[model samples]
Target: MSAQKRLVWPDVAKGISILGVVLLHIGIGVPEGESTWLYQLNTWLDPLRMPLFFVVSGYFSTKVLQFTLRDVLVKRVWFFLVPYIIWVSIELWTKNLEWQWVFGNEPLTWRELGLNLVLGHNMGWFLHALIMFNLALVAVRKLHPALAMLLSFTPILLLPLNEHIFFIGKALMYLPLFFAGVYFRQAITAFVDAVCRLNVPALMFAVITYAVGFFSRDLWNQFTGEVVLPWYLPGMDYMGSQEVLLLVRFVEQTFQLPMALVMAVAIARIPYVSSFFAFIGRNTLPVYLGHPIALTVGYHYVQIVGQWEISMDGERLVNTTWFWTFVCIILSGAGGLMLWSISKVPGIGWTVYPPSLRQLQEMVMRPPVLRSEPCRD
Candidate 1:
């Protein structure tokens, strides 16, 4: 396949993943009864959503591996770290302001704030973990490829450390996926192509597996009054024994990974859908950065309109329906576009989205000087 053609499916996959991420976040905020269709839909997608994103990210990280360590660092600084720090600072500031004004709570301590930033607290953790994963991948690949493969399992052993220290826990959880992308990029592409060729049967199988896994979790959660599966959501914390944790992780990986890949392949095969997703995928950074800001703005608007309320059960409630879910998605996309538009401005663009190193070089480099003798000649 040509280079451009090869990129189409991956971009489509990425677009689908980012949209899923936004949808998942929307699901997170809006609590629903277990019987609701929206609830089940969210439940079904929960496992596949973030894992697919990490896998896609990992697949792309292969390109980064070719760069020198200095170049890699520079890339991360402008593309990842700078944006991470700036947006994180803004998020923290806004969150604190919300706490004080809305909830009348004391502000976070300097130490607490510093730790959160360092740890990449909340939604920004993905970028933090990604930076670490890339750095680790670079270090490991310096050894033999086989040895590097072996090192990928180091995170699995540290599964207990998941969600513990700064980005370490999350990094460990997703590192294998990232490394899988790096090492098995060709294999994965072949697998996706093969699956895509199977067409209807492949898509059906993917859907069936996802539904089965979703309902299986729902059944377990219904019986236990808690989600027994290993889901990394806010309220669904895993406090089980080591043995249980291991089992949950096993079940989750086994079910989630295949479903995510299958769904990605299925989505990539659809012409119009793939193009839409590819567009979103190509511009994901801005979407990822700006969606939270958009959501916050929408939240305040709802609040002002008396549409936001706290449920008696202490669950935060907004007057939301399926219609509003679509609205939120549109708003989120709009937010990303707005940020992207702002990024085109001359002086202040870097604050929203950092400039590429090539762009920076072009901006800073002086024009070549022509010698006087050459001019005379």
Candidate 2:
């Protein structure tokens, strides 16, 4: 397959994953209940969503990962860092603005924003994590590929550390899957293609296994009496019983990877589905960076009315999960378009593509080196 054709599925995967992210954020502060199917759906997708994105990102970073430290810093680290710094600042500013104007909540101080930018403390942490993962992989780049992969498990096994170091914690949590993508690219590609062919059984197995894992997770929580920690968002804190969380994490991770790949391939094989998602995938950067701002604006506007749901024909369905789901879809689509439009404007476009002249000069001046093999420890 041509290089461009090869990327269609990964892009499709990214498109879907990003959309999932938007949907989750759009529902923020909406109360969760058993009947909230959208909430349930988001819960179900939580595990697979980011792991898939990281893996796909890792797949594409193979050559860059092999670059020398300088090239890696310029090409990969700087690439993610520029936008991360810019957008995190914008996102924090928007949040403070909204809180000050509408919610009467204490706004984050500039010091807080500065600290968050350093610590990867916002929704933009994906970009933040990318910088670290690229650098982290550098140390093991020349280890026997298998040994390096085995070491990737180190982070997941030391999962307890996530509590004390939440910023590095999040990056470490996803690093193994990212490493899998880098080290096992060929095997993963073959698997995706094979599932695309045997899509029916593949999908069924994927769904069944995922369902089993999902439900069993709830059961495990019930069994263990797992409680949400104070500092973490629902379903995100790693401060629970270490032994049980490890088992839970392992099962979830194992099931999540296959399910993610299957879902992407399944979507890619459909007639119109593949192309549509691929288009979204191709244009994900704008949506990823802009959707939070868009959603934040929409959210506060809704808060002014003191209602989280919409009115249709003079009827308010405040508790209708489907209504919220529909609204999220509409907002996500509109937000994406709005961001895309804003990106076309001059000068202001730096919010999305904020690279310094020095960085640009470095990129242009640097010559590509043969893939470096770091000295093995």
Candidate 3:
């Protein structure tokens, strides 16, 4: 068994990954039918995003729950469900989206809301997928990790990988990543330890994996078209869904297990980079939420500074694929820096995952000392 050791690159990688996601979201208006340089960057970075998140999430599997299923659900509620509802509602309201129009709802039932929540049918889909993914860890322990992955993976048959609602679809999609986090944690530790040794063969293997994966993706696109590219994920056309999922599992473990280990070892071996990223990793939530907000804030800032394009109501200029990419990085960094400030405050430090206003009102009303000012001499 591997003793618990901190893997620090995840912070910097997550910070980078999360920011990349924001940039990709900002890149929404770019045409999607063909291979472009922007698209390639998106794909290269895309694999890291969720897989890394599941890996980080996996590390805490035992840390979070053990005895009761209720405990698991409760923590998920506080961290995921509650935040998702709050944020999605905020997104919909701010973007002037009518919930009625978006979901085509005439009568809104809790059942429908719950379905929407699980399916990630709303704006906060990442968080939605997160809820189901974490729940999978707690639910399926009787089976071997590989068997659990296979069983959980069955939902891919019924649901398309684009994104789906059934619990199994999510379970299978992310379960492998999470399992790797927990089960192979020692493997990861060993890999990192080996990386600490820094043998030439290990580094060469890492490079080879990157090359095969990258070129395989390009080759898939060139030969089969974008539709059939990535013939080994939840949604590749060449193989059946299960077969592809199995292949993706092999590739991820083959590549990511070592990649995360080697890269993490490389980063942690460095003193300054480790310290900086670890601090950011500890404060991951704020940057995740604040990044997109900051990008828009930056876009408005640029506008005020005269570099802004005058976008007519139907025509928007701030969302070009290239420009918005930089915008997201700068804004996300700004948000991280700002969060570093708020985190310093006494008695108000929980804003990173801000509680509901109802919760806040109660906290304020029950305060021990009012905001009473002292008289100075």
Candidate 4:
């Protein structure tokens, strides 16, 4: 395979991640009683979604240590930070607007918004995590790569801080996976390549592996009293301690990684499916940044639908729960893509391709590069 073809799977995986995220958020607006399918689907794929994205991101960042500190900071760190600041601001403003409109009260003040931005208390948290992880990697670059990976897990020791500093806890949770991508890039690539050429039996084994991981998780959840277990397994009503839950989560994600790779390669083998998702994957920056805004607005409409009472033969009717749920999902994905298109215009492009204050000035003074796109990697 050509280099480009070989590289297509990560983009395809990213396409899946962004879409799964959008689906999860859209499902949140659905009424609990009516959300069974959405809930189950999102829950089953949870391990694959963000984990795959982070691993791919880490794989791309494998060379960060080789770059000058300034280049890493300016080009990569600032690249994500600038957008995180701008969009988190927009997210806060729109949320404040919603609170005022819906409840006739503004719960978030300018002070609170500023604090949230600093702490990253919003959906744009993935970007915030990217900033911290990159900085963390830079700080440890002088250490042996394995030692750095080991140190990344030390963040888990700060589980207590999770209650107050949510983003820190989350970044710590995924940091090891990011490090894995950095140190194990060769092994991961070879594994993915091998999976892509799988025959039917091998493919079935891959599917069975994924199914076993998810099913075993279901059994674990039952053991922890989170869900029902198999009849043969004794029903142990154990409320899992925090440490145990964390361990299980890591274990499940470990099982999920290879399956996600296999699935991505499987998708890439199909021509049109590969092209469509890979396009989204390449443009994931806009989708990931814009989808929350779209979903938030979409949720406002969904809430309005929930309150909708139609008079049918002088009786009240409040149906269409599933209908609206599907609608919101479709529209949210479309809206995010629409924002992606809007971001192509020069001046407004900064909404997606946000530059630091210095880069902003330089970008304006210089003419655009001919075929330049944002670094999808």
Whose TM-score is higher: candidate 1's or candidate 3's? 1
Predicted structure 4: lDDT: 0.75
List, residue by residue over 1-377, the lDDT tens digit for candidate 2.
Answer: 34554677898889888887887776664343324666568777788888888899889878965688887887677767877787768878887887777768787887888888887778788888888888878878878888887887666545455565566456555777788889889978877766766757666777787877677677777765555434233434445565446557556755667888887876877888899998888877778877777666665556556655442222557655556556666766787787677667877766665566586689899998899898998
Instruction: Look at candidate 3 and tell me the lDDT of residue 369.
Output: 68
lDDT of each: 0.68, 0.73, 0.56, 0.75
The TM-score that candidate 3 achieves is 0.67
Give me the displacement of residue 218 in model 3, in angstroms: 2.6
lDDT of 1 at 84: 81
Which predicted model would earn the best TM-score? Answer: 4
**In terms of lDDT, which candidate is stronger, 1 or 4?**
4
Candidate 2 residues lying further than 4 Å off, grouped into runs, are: 1-5, 31-34, 101-104, 156-161, 199-219, 224-239, 242-247, 305-325, 354-359, 362-377
Worst 10 residues of 4 by lDDT: 228-237
Best by lDDT: 4
The TM-score between candidate 4 and the true structure equals 0.82
Model 3 collision count: 0
Ranking by lDDT: 4, 2, 1, 3
Better of 2 and 3 by lDDT: 2
Error of 2 at 240 (Å): 3.3
Structural similarity to truth (TM-score) of each candidate? 0.78, 0.79, 0.67, 0.82
